[model samples]
Target: MRALIALGGNAMTGPDGSAAPEAQDVAVAAAMEHVADLVAAGVDVVLTHGNGPQVGNLLVKNELAASVVPPVPLDWCGAQTQATIGFLIMDSLERALAVRGVRRQVATVVTRTRVDSEDPGFSRPSKPIGRYLPENEAKVLVEHGESWERRGDKGWRRVVASPEPLEILDAPAIIELAKAGYVVVGAGGGGVPVVRDADGTLRGVEAVVDKDLAAT
Candidate 1:
């Protein structure tokens, strides 16, 4: 039997929403206990995980450092967190399996999900991200043509387009790895949202994809 495990971003963070490396390591180690059991029981497993918290933190960092360094784009932030979270999952899972005397190859793919360039989601940015900013800060960003939305008593946050995922470009590779008796991890943060150009080139977009939808 084969199973695909989709872990939420919270699974790798502290209960209080900390994304520190040590906190992530502990969280991933705990989650991998179950995954190791599945692998040990002869189940092929493929893993996908959310990066909401991690990527949000990255965006906050981008904003905090904008004057010192170029701010990373949303797509790039997704890619960064994918790799960061993937490393934590892969390493912890390997240790978990080893503890059970199970030997298996583990790998993570830097995946991409395609979306239509004309998706209506682009015109209406609705996915909120990063730490909420003070009214003054939020207004400053809005004045610069960025989308900011208020959430209840919380301050304001940036909102980005969240389009449906059309394809997991690395699905074949992920499947092949799982079939070859490897524990595969892929499609982190809905696979770094991208769109194909008319000239056949693919470009990353400043959008988010629902990780659950992409996992499906």
Candidate 2:
């Protein structure tokens, strides 16, 4: 049977965790080892992952170096995490299959998810993202047009409206890869949010998509 796996962010935050990219690759390997079991059992697996922690890390870096370099928008951050996590996962999946004497290719595609431009979430902006910050720090981001929302009892976090994913822009590529017997990893971080123009052209929006909602 073919399986579409929605891998969560926990895989990247494993016990051996460090912020280093190499460490991330190791984490990905660890996660893939479990998936390897299914592959050994004749399952064709496709992976989509979460970037909650990874994107938060990038935001911290951007905040720390705001004066030195331009800050990356939320949508761009999502894309970066997609590529970053996809790289490690794809490499690790390749090794996992090889160890089982299963020779199959793995591919990662940077995916886009379409949402309605009139989404009410855009005005409300209530999806928590990036690192949780103290109230004072959140005020700083708010001053610059980034707002905070209550995150349970912990603290406030930057929130972006997580609109529904209407379509996956990379569906064709993902379908083709899976049909060709490759383990396809796509739609990370829900997908970089895109909105369709009146003329039907799509452009990246400054928001993050919920990973699970995209899977739905």
Candidate 3:
């Protein structure tokens, strides 16, 4: 049977709390070990993943790059994060399969998901970015019109609205790719969270969509 796997952000996270390329490679390697089990069973697996950390890193990159170039928007950042992590997962999985003398095709597609333009999330701006903060710091963030929630002993972190995914804008393409026997990786960062314009053109939205909810 063919299966779509939505990998959690923590899956690619390093134990050292660093998501550096080396660390991510270590983490992705471990993740593929598990996926290899399914592949060994002859299951065709398509992978999707979350970018809760990767996107935050990308935001920092945007901030740092702002002095040199126009800061990339969150939608574009999300797309980039997917491309990065998707490949990490894809390449590792394919390598594991090959080492075991199995031949399988693995591909990562930058996916876009459509959301309602009128989504209330735009006004709320609840999705938290960056690091966690203490109560006082969180209060300051709240004053700035952001949301924060407690994160165990690490203090509070921002919480964003993470709206439900209405539709996978490229679901048909993904299905086609999968049918062609490729282990497709699509729908990262919940597929770029897009909206429909009045002219029927799809535009990227500013809000994040929950990847797990979208995968479901």
TM-scores of all predicted structures? 0.93, 0.88, 0.84
lDDT of 3 by residue, 1-216 (tens): 988777887778889667788888999999898887898788988888888878888766654454466666677888889889878887899999888888887888899888877777765667777676678856654564445688789988766655668989888998898899888989987889888899989887567888888887
- What ranges in model 1 sit over 4 Å off? 139-146, 149-154
lDDT of candidate 1 over 131-173, digit per residue (tens): 8888777776665556888877988889999999999999999
Could you tell me the C-alpha RMSD of candidate 3 in Å? 4.2
Q: Over the stretch 1-216, how does candidate 2's per-residue lDDT look in tens digits?
A: 988888777668756545567667777888899998898898989899998878878989876665566677888899999998888887888888898998988899999999999999988887676777777766666666666786877888887888888999898999998999888999998999999999989998878787898987
Task: State how far residue 80 of model 2 sits from its true place (Å).
Answer: 0.8
Task: Tell me, by lDDT, which candidate is best.
Answer: 1
- The order of the candidates by TM-score, greatest first, is 1, 2, 3
lDDT of 1 at 185: 94
Query: Judged by lDDT against the true structure, how good is candidate 1?
Result: 0.89
Error of 3 at 141 (Å): 14
2 or 3, which is superior by lDDT? 2
User: What is the alpha-carbon lDDT for the whole of candidate 2?
Assistant: 0.84
